[model samples]
Target: MEERLIMDLVPGLEGIPAAESAISYIDGDEGILEYRGIPIETLAVKSNFIEVAYLLIFGELPDRDEYERFKSDVTYHTRLKLKILRMMEWLPENGHPMHYLQAVTSAMGMYYPARDTLDEEVRYWSAVRLIAKLPTIVAASHRLKHGDEPIKPRNDLSFAANFYYMLFEREPLPLVERILDTMLTLHADHTMNASTFSSRVVGSTLADPYTIVSSAIGTLSGPLHGGANEEVVRMLAEIGTKENVRPYIEARLERKEKIMGIGHRVYKTRDPRGEVLKGFIEELIAHKDIDSGVFELSKEVELVVAERLTGKNLHPNVDFYSGIVFNGMGIPTDLFTPIFAMGRVAGWLAHWMEQLKTNRIYRPTQKYIGKRKEPYIPMEERKRATAR
Candidate 1:
């Protein structure tokens, strides 16, 4: 008799190897994240976002000439075409920025055709356009929604500083610019995250880079992923006073509700990204006079959460501290996830490139539990299901 194969179904595919990747790595148990074998902490502190993006996409750090060329390419392509901006003006003023980002990104494909996913030049320019214009799209969407003319990108500014300038029409202070760049580096990629996975899944189908990235942005907009930072800021605002931290936490726990940003699915200890953001938060607190109450409340919430939930290995994740950092810098709360999407786009494209190298459309098997073949009933013979 031929042997029968037995397969076990995994819910959510947890602990399942979806694909082989060389882009990024995470050791959840040890609280470590490395991109191309370099520690995240080293990259976050030493390298700028554009350089980090180049490394992630190209699989290695660039030489000085290579770095300059890549930076120039990205900077030169940062402005949206006037037609793109005109189209954006018609988007709903009350629409979520993420929706604007996704729609505009998908529409980019019509303007810059990249149907030949196998062509190197096509892939290179597509990557450049996607990376360069995401910040423009994000900032434009924000300004348009608020009834303001979108600020154009300044070619003279660094990647992070230019984004800040476009959003507020003023250059960030040196420290603020540095922190914003570091924040982008810190969020640039995480191994096989929801958005990265979405990118890979779409890329496997040989889709254009814009469509792949747009799909990933849609995935990141969900509350459980990049959207959590927005919720974290809201949670802090709701807590109001530092004294209310414990009570708010206790009540949430008592009601079996989630304390947004307090836990992560992979890390058993505090998230490494969270640790980096905490350090920056300290620096901002000492140097900047912006609202420190949110920062203080964040600390108290973390402390209370640690006191109550540490034994269960629930600790502050990246979302917990990132909002405070952005909020302190005078960023709008809704823009948090769009900024995250901006950073993670590099990773999404990196994974898209890698996926094409060993392309096989994802077709995971499912264990069926529904009824098998049944006799077809005549329309008159079939009874309507009883209403619950």
Candidate 2:
């Protein structure tokens, strides 16, 4: 063994980059976003969610025949397995749906036990099942908890349309569907964030994609991670009305508290997704007659907070505007994270497939800080140390 310096990266610690994908790209500093090399604003106005997903997975926009086939295949697989339905029924109504989703996805791996003949075809089908059933599972969990009837998936509608239908048991208005589709595309992927990193870590073990995605979902459930959207909604609700915005933000700044949705790990300037979502909120407010004062309040909060903390280099992220948009769409506050999972599932599956193409077990070493060769003493023999 080489006995490297503490906290140093050993050989092969930094893995090779995967194949070039035409998925979403993040330029954190410039606050620019692109999907398939086209700017996000262009896609938001022209492309739909399904088209974006196909592009991410298959490397380009599908032709008419290919798009139709892809839509049919996904729609056919949208219905949950009977056993999975029963499993959802068994979950407590008060339980968080993300927890239920993580459990169900892990259980799915056991139900469809892995085989020695796991080939590309197997992986492809596994991806299909995961992508198809995720929305159904999330929608069912939402309805079950709220004591509402679960709506069956309609094969004729687009992915975003069907998801809205299942959630509300009615077809969504065209503008609503368009906004949601764009939102999905915007969130489909980014360069290796926390949840994507978690999926890749699990996948590096040559584990099944289902297990990898399940682990990713668990990582995303943390408040500091995927739950930021929920916190944003909560923050807005507490702020109450337009009149309270300034004072509320000023008070928060004085306490030196970090506002949810106001900062990012990768983006030092502004988040491009935040810009896109803000536009969506503006459209929804104007055309849909939705109250978007909360969005204005959030913007004011961003400005005041940034000015006060100058050197902190804070900026509002995607989650900042997403909360207002979802709230305006009449989505319940509790379902925010589950909706985020809906968007992120596509990215997770894509990353998992990419990892399998170059499978390597992830095993990082940690610094050893504990005493070396310490004797194991009986419980009574040890003396308690005084607090410093």
Error of 1 at 137 (Å): 0.6
Per-residue lDDT for 365 in model 1?
A: 78
Show where candidate 2 strays beyond 4 Å: 1-24, 113-118, 292-313, 379-383, 386-388
How well is each residue in 132-183 modelled by candidate 2, as lDDT tens digits? 8888888888998889867889988878889889999988888778777777
TM-scores, all models, native as reference: 0.96, 0.88
Model 1 C-alpha lDDT per residue in residues 1-388, reported as the tens digit of each score: 9995649887867787888999889988888999999999899888989999999999999999999999999999999999999999999999999999999999999999999999999999999999999999999999999999999999999999999999999999898899888888889999987888899999999999999999999999998777788888888888889989999999999999998987788888768889988998777767755667778788888888879886798888888788888887889998998999889988998999999998999987789989989999999898878955
Task: Tell me how many clashing residue pairs each candidate has.
Answer: 0, 0
Model 1, runs deviating above 4 Å = 1-6
- Alpha carbon lDDT of each predicted model: 0.90, 0.77
Score residue 294 of candidate 1 by CA lDDT: 76
Candidate with the greatest TM-score versus the true structure: 1
Q: Lowest-lDDT window of 10 residues in candidate 1?
A: 284-293
